[model samples]
Target: MNRFALCYFLLCVSSAATAQDKEVQAIRTRYQETAKKVQLLEQDPQNAALYVHRISLNDKGTPWPAVGNYKKTIKFYFELGDEQVHTLVRIDITSESAAHQYATEYLFDAKGQLVFCYDRMPDGQSPENNIEVRYYFSGDKPIRRTEGKTISDKPSPEQQPQAKRLQSDAAELQSLFKAIDK
Candidate 1:
């Protein structure tokens, strides 16, 4: 009778532990799915940017006018996978006649701790300003950061002054990214 009781107790304990492990695994799987979304976004910023922007596009392929007092807009995109989280935010500046787009990206670990981040202001064909920033982290702590900017270059005095400062800034950012990649 004593031996049977001991075996039963151990079996109960093992079953409880297995249940707990399954629960933990489920939570981790959900978290990982969320993080992967960000990695997918980074792999295709332009398409992702376009996808977000299309939420407000018109038939003519141009952005529609602001509806009311709201002239600026913000959007958040998230992805999780492999115990990592990626987040992207886009800020839009809208006026009566023009609009601008800015965005930020972030990454987090399985424990919901930030692991990396990247901020970007895409330099589209437009002659305008641009900016990019990146941060790398380890175990909820940032270990490195890189920032870059592109100021359009003003056209020569003999010609019309184009959005030169923004162009210049974009070029600078490109070189900066290249350096860091190496």
Candidate 2:
């Protein structure tokens, strides 16, 4: 309305764009440095699941580290509403931590565009502590937001992270899941 108000709005919009560009470039740089990761993305699709994760706390407002980012990956499988195959690949990140007491999950379409995002609770408070991401995309480009199903139960003791027991346990679980999913 007023000239001062309009100027303020424009500055805010410009600053936001700059911040987003920086974030994307930082991620791309990380990908470049890890050439092996890029190679895997080109080669083994399954193993490329490694890139499916990253860590980032939301600071879009307020100070840095006000939130906590637990896990992220560049590759994930999705089966929604009887889809024939995994419809979208994502670079997923979660911002949830004990200290901040906030959690957010985002799904970027394969082409690295935000398709849909679940901020805090999209529909309502989830029954569990974990956040669920549900989004749609056209090929690699994003289509729109979608309903998300979540795991209400807590992670099992075996699922808890352990320094030494992780590898063997993960391998064993992966085998079990393979058999069961089949």
Candidate 3:
């Protein structure tokens, strides 16, 4: 009777695990199906130029500490045989009080989709405070991962200032694209 009870317990445990696996697999399938329905965007040169123009304007409007306190550079790359353009922005800000460099790269697909982005910024006095994020997108949905750190819990709004800035930047970029599309 004891041996029979142990076997039954093992079987039940295995069955529960198998059921959970099936549920996870089902969810993954649904996610993939939804992602497939998200259409890839086409590349538009005129629109792309407009996007660059608008972002450049915003970057220019960033208040520097002084007239000679900052330097800004923008570079664009077009992929061969792919309808993709990549833009890299570098801003070096120096103040008598402090100095830091901020850089971000944006990748847009042929379909005017912002497919990937990497943003890097200085964290307080500690190099560890430096925040870097790389985001991958399928259409408008973002899959994001941060390098060099882990968080035990979800960050509160106050703890996510950089993310908020990036989100705002992405929104502006999207609006520029939409304006050109119209």
Candidate 4:
């Protein structure tokens, strides 16, 4: 109520906002760096390690010719080092269908934490009908999210669950890749 008290409260609030803004900027920088690493590795395919897995949804044990059910394909990309350590950098999951087609890409940090995820689906035959969503994470938490052309500094309630699902999927895929590698 008093002038001094009001001024102090405003100053504290302003400081908090400034700190949050700085933190968000740092996260965005990290995201950009990670994205660059992925892009570079992807460009140089000869040096990158990639594993592809295909899933069939047919009731019978049939191959690709059987077209009634949906088919899913997953691609895992790893960064290879001289130390013989293969670090998983990206995972792409694509579902094939005549009517509905969607793809999700997940990117992991050096610590094997989910750092970013992108999901895209086409609403129609044209490129303009594409729906895209991107999520940027800090550790296991999503720090920012974007849908289409809109961006949000704070993750929505739905993003928490989606982040968890992506993390789980990444872990499972990593384990499968390790087993197959051995």
Best by lDDT: 4
Write the residue-wise lDDT of candidate 3 on 3-75 in tens digits.
9999999999899767645643543453344233221112445433222322242344455555434545543
- Poorest 10 consecutive residues of model 3 by lDDT? 88-97
**Relative to the unseen true structure, what is the C-alpha lDDT of residue 110 in candidate 2, on a scale of 0 to 100?**
41
Model 2 residue runs over 4 Å out of place are: 36-182
Query: Predictions ranked by TM-score, top down?
Result: 4, 3, 1, 2
- In model 3, which regions exceed 4 Å deviation? 1-68, 79-98, 126-129, 149-167, 171-182
Clashing residue pairs in candidate 2 (N, C-alpha, C atoms within 3 angstroms)? 51-74, 52-73, 52-74, 52-75, 53-72, 53-73, 53-74, 54-72
Candidate 4 structure quality by residue, lDDT tens digits, 40-92: 65687455344334343443524455453466777666666668777776777
TM-score of 4: 0.66
Report the lDDT tens digits of candidate 1 across residue range 73-132.
323343323454232222222222243455544433444444444455646656266556
Superposed by TM-score, candidate 4 places the C-alpha of residue 102 at a distance from the truth, in angstroms, of 0.9
Q: Sorted on lDDT, highest at the top, how do the candidates line up?
A: 4, 3, 1, 2
Estimate candidate 1's RMSD in Å.
20.8
